[model samples]
Target: MVDFQEFCKHLPFGLLIVNYKGEIIYKSQICENLLNNSDPNIKHIQDILPDSSIIKVIKEGKFDISPYKLKEEMYLIQIALEPGKLGGILFIPEGVIQDIINASPRVLELKHELESIMNLSGELVTISDSNGIILRVNNACEQIVGVKEHDLIGKSVYEMEKSGVITSSSTKYVLEKKQKVTMKQTTKSGRRLMVDGYPIFNNDGSLNKVINISKDVTEISILKKRLEETKNLLDYYQKELYVFQKSEQEIVYQSKAMEKLYDLACRIADVDATIFLHGETGVGKEVLARTIHNLSNRKDAPFIKVNCGAIPESIMESELFGYSKGTFTGGHKEGKKGLALAAHKGTLFLDEIGELPLNLQAKLLQLLQEKQFTPLGSTSPVQVDVRFITATNRNLEEMVREGSFREDLYYRLYVIPIAVPSLAERKEDIPFLINYFAEKYSHKYNHYKTFHPEVIQLFVDHKWKGNVRELQNTVERLILTVPSSQIEMHHLPDKLINTKTKVRGNMNLKQAMEQFEKQILIQTLETSATMREASKKLGVDASTITRKVKKYGINIAKLQFLL
Candidate 1:
């Protein structure tokens, strides 16, 4: 008979014996070879087969057979408790089932077909055992991760990470989670990768392998960054375009004072703070307020303008706070939403706010403080979401002192007080405004007209106490009523023509004389039909008058136009 050790080594299956303490007592030569262990003694069977069911078999004294996976191979294992002792024995077939399958011609063909499919993929594909050993990698792996198949295959992912071949591994996460995982990784080639890892399990519910599919997203990431930058640049240019268009259409100005004021308006446009516009009448305060509303986030909402001074005091409360149905005789049967409610989620411009009655000022103050107000005949307070932009020509501070305007209401409206300058203060913008309004009214009345130089000079010199409103009305009147295309000094209103040009600074005798002479020549040219008539009226030779006319740069054509 053969010796026991030799006979056990010659057996076709691998065997392991464990004592009741679950410590390995004996292992055959085939078992040692199958487990890839060369040691004479092993501490536990779990050291080789970590998922072994031998301990349960010993505890319950039961017998069971199951498939055990090791690395990339599968083996059928037989587990049974010892007949008379509190010990267990595990029988593992020496020939792996995967090896038997690999030997078949059909399985080999399918394996080659699968490998061809995997290598043909554009995305990097990798397979690693549960122990972190890389078993296979596709051809795309070299192009994406800059690693060769031979270099990564059979190598440990942890070692590759330590060696800096790849920055991180999704396989590590899959192993930890025992589920699918997706992560971003970088390689030594400086390529960004989006990797999705899937954990594959065996029939015994034990981790078998991790499959990682990776896509090179380096170009996509760069393109995304560039797209974001382009979008931001487009937004900036669009805003600049809006400001330019707005300046040309509305709030036309060129003076540094107006420029600075408009810049402040734009800066505070989007904020929800209450804006108080204070200026003289006809100073374009309403236009400026509308500009603010257009630039604000509520540009799409309603812009309700209520002239506090225009409405009568008796119905002012109902017009502002709205009234319920049948609140008063002859009232609308369905009731009105009122100016405040109509301007919901928008701007409410209360022009001449200082003219608001004392009692209504209290209600306005309540609305400003609490964002809610009661209708005239309603017991319940209706909420409102309105941005307040109030304008006044009167001094609210003086009114507050006189007990005419509410002190609390005045302070509430004074949160962001912006003083709009009168047109006379920004005289540099006068010529441009005149031209804009001239062209505007010319279009409105369907007549084209131009102002004579002398008429424009008179407009610039005259102190427009009525501000822009007076100037706009004058331009509209001239455009409508002036018979000729060229508007001269005689075409102006008597008030504008008779107005004396105020000498702004201290002038010497020569400068005063020259200015007086220029004015006389202009006036004489307006009345006189001919150059000879103007010279005779001045009691000067025609040549002297012509020399003074040239010196003063006076347009002799005005006399011709008048004729």
Candidate 2:
């Protein structure tokens, strides 16, 4: 039989023999090479391997195994008692430790349990190396990533991304960032996925592996898109409904000019700026101001209207700013809340703003700028929150030049000036207005009536100097005074009918003749059923009548109702 030392030398491991006192008695040449020392006699085992388990093995006299590191290499240190129980023998085997552990029953059972748990998870899980090479994937990979485990395993993430298997790779980002990463990705099968990647690091703080988990968000994404579309459609229909309601309840017009003006008003209704309305005496500026107030955030609050021209100069200040008790003999016992205070947190419409007294403009300016005012016979300033909407038919700039208006107040009110179009400017809306007023007053006076085509034609041809007010007043008069159900030409005021034949003194004979010819054509078209009939009645060709109608800019559609 070979001796112990010679036998240990031929073994595929380093060997050492320590006595009961923990001193090394024998060591193989392999052990000397591993420890980097040739002499070992009389040296304690602790001196060679400071963290060794030789002393415990000697005391127990049992076989044991542990992991040990010498320099950068790892070894499995197996310790056992020597013969006669005098010492302990240590076997340091190079490599093959992992193979031994994997072959063990307990380790194999634990590995199978971990793999089962990973496979049963609902989220898609994948393990890849630092180089983006896929190592393992769970069963959820097929449902989420649209790829089977066998197809994805052992493949490079970079290669799969280039082939359109996935839109992007979270593992690649994890390797680059050396930390956790999350991102949205799309698969070749049109699945949207939210993926999270966790990186595993080595003992030296280097990236070792990346574990990725993904969730399917395809249905959620589609639902989110559909919800956005539905919300947009609802907003569009809501705006249309609002416009329809406004047209019925307030201002009525079918002209493009009015449409554009109302669109601008609605757009700026929410803003808290001082608006100045400029128009003729009866172009409906007050109505527009009220519409703005109704559309604003303060619709629930009070809307106070003050006609600056209607208030007497002697009592204007007291009426607008209120007066303390006993300020005058005729005053009420208690102090009063003025119109400005009554309009708190709401709108204050100042019609005929140009008619405001020159001295009072300064106080009005103070209220507008500071939102506070001094009541009559009171020393304290009363606070208010009022939105000012001023309207005037007179030229404010001319008044400013004439020293009748304050320049500062003009600028403050001129912040947002809207020029309301006159009825003559938007003549296309006249017919609709006439019909609306006719129906309105006929119901009011309990008389069901209509207007003859000739009467409507004369009304359209007449210039309405007072704008909508004049037209509305004329319609109301016709509905009330006319006894017949159909209002005829004789019922109209002479001024309106005379407009058809009245010639300005400034016109030459040829101009007057052309005007006369235009009137004749209009009258004939109103009586005839067609252009051919009108031409026959006038002794001219139908083409010549058509050319003359075009030259005169006649609206034949308006006359179609008569035919």
Error of 2 at 259 (Å): 4.0
Clash totals for all candidate models: 0, 0
| Candidate with the greatest TM-score versus the true structure | 1
lDDT of each: 0.82, 0.82
Q: How do the residues 1-563 of candidate 2 rate in per-residue lDDT, one tens digit apiece?
A: 88877777787667777777777777887778777987636388877887776677667766666667775355645355663244554544545566778889999999898789887768788999989999988888888777889999999999999999999999989988888999999999999989999999989998889999898889999999999999767745644565667435657876678888888877777688999999998999998898888777778899899999999998889889998877878678897879999999999999999999999999999999999999998999999999999999999999999999999999999999999999888765676688889988988899988986555655666799999999999999989999999997677777876784562545555665576568667766766778788889789998999899999998999877232
lDDT of 1 by residue, 1-563 (tens): 88877877777677777765668877887666667897766587677767766777776777666666554344545355573344544445436555666899999999899789887768999999999999988889788888888999999999999998889988988999999999999999999999999999999999999999998999999999999999767745644566677435467776668878878877788889999999998999999899889877899999999999999999999999999988988899988868899999999999999888888988999989988999988998999999999999997888888888888788899999999999878775677688889888888788999987666666777888889999988899889999999998678777875673343255544565576568667766655667788788779987887788889888767555243
RMSD of each: 10.9, 9.3
Worst 10 residues of 2 by lDDT: 83-92
Candidate 1 yields a Cα-based lDDT of 0.82
lDDT of 2 at 397: 99
What clash pairs does model 1 have?
Answer: none
Q: Best candidate per lDDT, number?
A: 2
